[model samples]
Target: MRRAASMGMTTPTTPVAIDPADLAGVFDRYARDLLRYCTRRVGEQVAEDVVAETFLVAYERRDRYDASRGEVLPWLYGIATNLLRRHRRTEIRALRALAHADGGARAAEGPAQRATDRVDAERAVGRLSAVLAKLPRRQRDVLMLFAVAELEYAEIAEALQIPLGSVQSALHRARAKVRAALAEGDAR
Candidate 1:
């Protein structure tokens, strides 16, 4: 410890190792974040499956985790991302279903806005979901990682195995497209 301190070396914040058999601890630590990200990506329909498969893959490949790259959270996210790829059609279908379903109409049932405003707001939201469904896969993934997963740029880059600049570029393009779509929708 004295030798390390003499060299100005410091301990890392996150743990660099875990017992493979103690995966329950890992799951308890990260399942909520995974659930939220998965749910946002694929909706409640199959988010559980994605999260479960991610953990299963992680447990199966526990030895492959390189702590030097980053934390366990991002590693788990990377696994979840791979699983999400297989569910791309599921995501698109869910988004389109939301766009067409009246399930959320009651969510805006509050009397805050008049009937037309409520209808317009609902329509605008539907348009937004449709636009999200239409975003290119990489753009959508980057957007969801940043927006829903709340992963930092470097974390997202690590999770997706992309360059940091790619993460930034993809996020920029996604936000611009979403803004443009929303603006157009509002103008209607």
Candidate 2:
């Protein structure tokens, strides 16, 4: 190495390369949750693709990630949420169908007491989806990231790249709409 005084100008240090281990850690921690969230939003068939693509995108952009800002799971979730947006119509249609399906006996759940619990759970999910489908896309996204993903308001704001106040406002509106819908359903 040349002496600083002799060289007059010190060469800049090389940029740090992203470690593969970091990405691996992210994948290990978040892949299952990402897949589950995607499946909930878009169904099982395309959830895998969405989650795979999410990790690929995260890996490619790993250098830009700011660990100081937040955790990897929210970032992965944001990516998965964006991918799910492309399949919104498919999700809405699928939810609509599910909401309307008669609680028929399934191959797995035989006509036992257990099936009753399963059917009740399915109906609850179906009703939730039917209500979710009616929400504005932005409001729905904010709601899901908060309610389904169980993210904090700050995390949702960071993940969605929106103001914290906007996240709050959207969540409030979405919750109100959902409560209204559920109440209306109860009356029926």
Candidate 3:
């Protein structure tokens, strides 16, 4: 045992010299952020799978990762975004399901305030979904990453592989469209 220990035969080889503990810490810290981003991009139901695939891909490609470039969050965001793009059909399906659920009229209950509040919340989310569907993919992505994922413009640009200016422009256009839709609804 002493000979094996001295020879380092019992030690497992990792891709890099970085300690596995450090890697685990990094994952723990960022996992929730990545999961939230995935949920917003796709839906909560598929978010777990997207996050698992993202981390798996990141691990496999760890050798090529450049730590000196910047923080790992943006790189991970880029990976998650790419995965989300592949599942656009699923996202559309989720949106449609939400819209259908929202299309039904809610039951009025005079006695229960909580039930009324829940119905109102669902109605608002459904309206938002309807508006979100009308946005171009890039614009919708930028809007969600900014508002839901709470990513900075530079991070959004990196994830979407767009210019920083494009991120700003896309968000501006997306917000304007959403506002116009809300205005039209109010007018009605």
User: Which candidate has the top score in lDDT?
Assistant: 1
Off by over 4 Å in 1: 1-18, 102-121
**lDDT on C-alpha atoms for all candidate structures:** 0.79, 0.75, 0.73
Instruction: Give the best candidate by TM-score.
Output: 1
- Write model 1 residue lDDT over 1-188, tens digit each, in one string: 01212222222554344446557867876898999999988887699999999999988886666544446777788889889989999989988986785635665565655566566677776787888899998899889888888888988888998999999999999999999998886787
Candidate 3, lDDT over the whole model: 0.73
* Model 2 per-residue lDDT tens digits across residues 32-115: 888877887888889999989998888788676654443556767788888889889988898888777655545245645555
lDDT (Cα, tens digit) per residue for candidate 3, span 68-91 = 445567777888888898998888
TM-score of 3: 0.80
Clashing residue pairs in candidate 3, if any? none
lDDT of 2: 0.75
TM-scores of all predicted structures: 0.81, 0.80, 0.80
Give the residue spans of candidate 2 off by over 4 A.
Answer: 1-18, 104-120
Q: Put the candidates in lDDT order, highest first.
A: 1, 2, 3
The whole-model C-alpha lDDT of candidate 1 against the native structure comes to 0.79
